[model samples]
Target: MDELVERVDAEDRVLGVVSRRDAVREGWLHRIGVVVCRDGQGRYLVHRRAEHLSRFPGHHELAVGGAVGVGESYEGAAARELSEEMGVRATVCLRFTFLNRSGLSPHWLAVCDALLPEAVAPDPREVAWHGWLTEPELRQALGQKTFTPDSREVFDRYLASRAAPATVRNRCP
Candidate 1:
């Protein structure tokens, strides 16, 4: 079954609704919500994409998520994805960090952050392997060609935010 997703513009204004396949094949700008999961120790939950995925198969992703459905808020999508892909509920608010664009994918990505207090149970269909990594470790891993393009962009932006000063980071919405 084709998943229904909201098509949007470069600025993320909704243009219409379309099938996920059409959104990709026709290069329609669509929204996807990503949740950056962190453990109590501040290690990030990184996972390898399932090999059977249609795009970026066997690549690493900094978060678990998917396209936002029609009439769904980014936060809602992020929460849903966190549950569906990782089987973990975020006890705190998933802060909307930033928007990332790869120019390689039609997805207008909304990145969020959540500190999960529960254990993760990655779904086999979306994640093949999972692990926790520190900032330096994630950056080093990103140097290799293992991460998906979109994921790389998202993680890079996230690391940049963390490195910025308190005031500077606060300026980001």
Candidate 2:
């Protein structure tokens, strides 16, 4: 079933609700929440998308996330995705938000952070495989392997936020 998601304007102001299919098909701006899960040791939980998945199948994702449901807050969606995809119930905080137009449609991606006390097995249906990669290792992997375009942008922006002089810092939807 297509999810119902909040459609937003350029500044992320809610315009109305729209089906996820329509949002993608029509290129409407919608909200997506992704959490950069980190272990106590600060390793990122990177996972490969299940081969059977329709979108970006067999590609690796650096975080766990999904669409922000209608009426759902970004943090709420991030937490929900973390639990649903990684089986970890952890507090997630919004790190930043940005418009990702690298993919088929534009989306306001809320990049959140969740420090996991420990690792947990991810849902096999969503994650084909997963591993914990350090910052340098992840950067290397991003160049060596195929990842979802949106994820690459997310990771790049995420890194830029910490190192660069400017970024999409603290933008919320």
With a 3 Å backbone cut-off (N, CA, C), the pairs that clash in candidate 1 are none
Q: 1-173 in candidate 1: lDDT tens per residue?
A: 99999988877788888998898888788988888888888888889989998878999988778889999988788899999889888742444444455634567777777887647898899889999988788888888748877777787677777677866665333
For candidate 2, the per-residue lDDT at 158 reads 74
| lDDT of model number 1 | 0.79
Candidate 2 least-lDDT 10 residues? 164-173
Residue-level lDDT of model 2, residues 33-83, one tens digit each, is 999888888788899999999878999988789999988999999999899
Winning model by TM-score: 2
**Which candidate gets the maximum lDDT versus the true structure?**
2
Off by over 4 Å in 2: 163-173
TM-score of each candidate structure, all chains considered together: 0.87, 0.91
Residue 19 CA displacement from its true place in model 2, Å: 0.5
**What's the lDDT for residue 63 in model 2?**
73
Q: Candidate 1 versus the native: TM-score?
A: 0.87
